[model samples]
Target: MHIKTKFFGDIELSTEQLWHFPKGIPGFESERKFALLPIEENLMFQVLQSTNDSDIALIVANPYTLVEDYSFDIDDPTIELLDIKQEDDIFVLGVLSLKDPLETSTINLQAPIVFHTSKKVAKQMIINDNKFAVRHIIGSQPSLTKEEA
Candidate 1:
């Protein structure tokens, strides 16, 4: 199907490429369905575009790639919501807050977006731990080099 996007304009995607967020992302509770679209030439980041609304796209990335020691337990409620069975069944991504300078960008580590691969469902699970910040500075963390990304 074809859908309008905030960054990529109009594009075609398979139905399997869409994700269903039953409860949707925090501030975007009304927007549930989304598609994880890759940024051209950038492996480290992706556009989590809402299939329902072209203006609601968010830049996301794997937190592990930005933070070396990033670790958090998925809350019981979220685990049950997505029907996650095993570690391999889910993948996590964090929303990014881009800044003027590339290095000044921050990622939301406190709340990671979890996707159930098989079910094609997802949610932004908020971590109860204080070890992570809502806006963790990406520049201070060890991340993939430009060549690697």
Candidate 2:
């Protein structure tokens, strides 16, 4: 199917490239379908483009790459919503807030977008824990003690 995107402009996509968000992402509940489009030459980031709306696109990346210690449990409600069965069935991506210098950019670690690979379903889940910040600087690295380093 051919669809227009905010960053990528008009492009053709296969059915397998589409993802169905039953509950949709926060604030955009009505926008259900999305396509994960890759940023040219960048494996760390991807654009979560709403198939229905050209303006509704989010830059997302694997939170683990930015925060090595990032960890969270998939709440029971989300598991059931996405029908997730095992760890391999799903992968998580955090929405990125691009900044002018790029190094000043931040990622929304508090709410990670979880995708079920086989099911083609996804949801942006808000973590109940306060361990992660809403806007974690992408360039910031976790400080390690001298012993650990």
Candidate 3:
């Protein structure tokens, strides 16, 4: 289907690209559907574009790329919401806040969007851990190889 996006403009998205967020995201409680669009030539980041709203798109990346040691447990409610069965079933991604200088960009580590690949279901889960911050500098950490990313 052809849909207009905030960053990518008009584009064609296959049904497989669509993800269903049953309860919607925190701020976007009504925007439940999203399309994960990858940025050209950039393997580290992707645009989580809201299918229902043209103006809603968030830059996301695998937090593991920057914080290799990052770890968090999914609460019982989220586990049931996403219907996650196993550890390998879900992948986590962090929403990024782009800055004037690219190096100063920060990622929201406290809340990571977890995607259940097989089910095409996703949820933005906010971790209650104090160790994880809402804004974490990106370039301060070591980079990961494509395989790792």
Question: What TM-score against the true fold does each predicted structure earn?
Answer: 0.93, 0.92, 0.92
- Which residue pairs clash in candidate 3? none
Clashing pairs in 2: none
Q: At residue 37, what lDDT does model 2 achieve?
A: 92
Residue 148 error, candidate 1, Å: 5.3
Candidate 3 lDDT over 1-149, as tens digits, reads 89999988999999888999998999999999999998876778899999989999999999988776799998888899989999999999999998967778999999999999999999999898999789988876543446666
Model 3 misplacement above 4 A: 140-149
Model 1 compared with the native: what TM-score?
0.93
Specify the poorest-scoring 10-residue window by lDDT in model 2: 140-149
- Tens-digit lDDT track of model 1 for 1-149: 89999999999999878999999888999998999998876778899999989999999999998988999999899899999889999999999999977789999999999999999999998887889999998995544445774
lDDT of 3: 0.90
Question: lDDT score, residue 70, model 2?
Answer: 95
Q: What do the candidate models score in CA lDDT, each in turn?
A: 0.91, 0.91, 0.90
| Model 3 clashes, total count | 0
> Which is the winner by lDDT between candidate 2 and candidate 3?
2
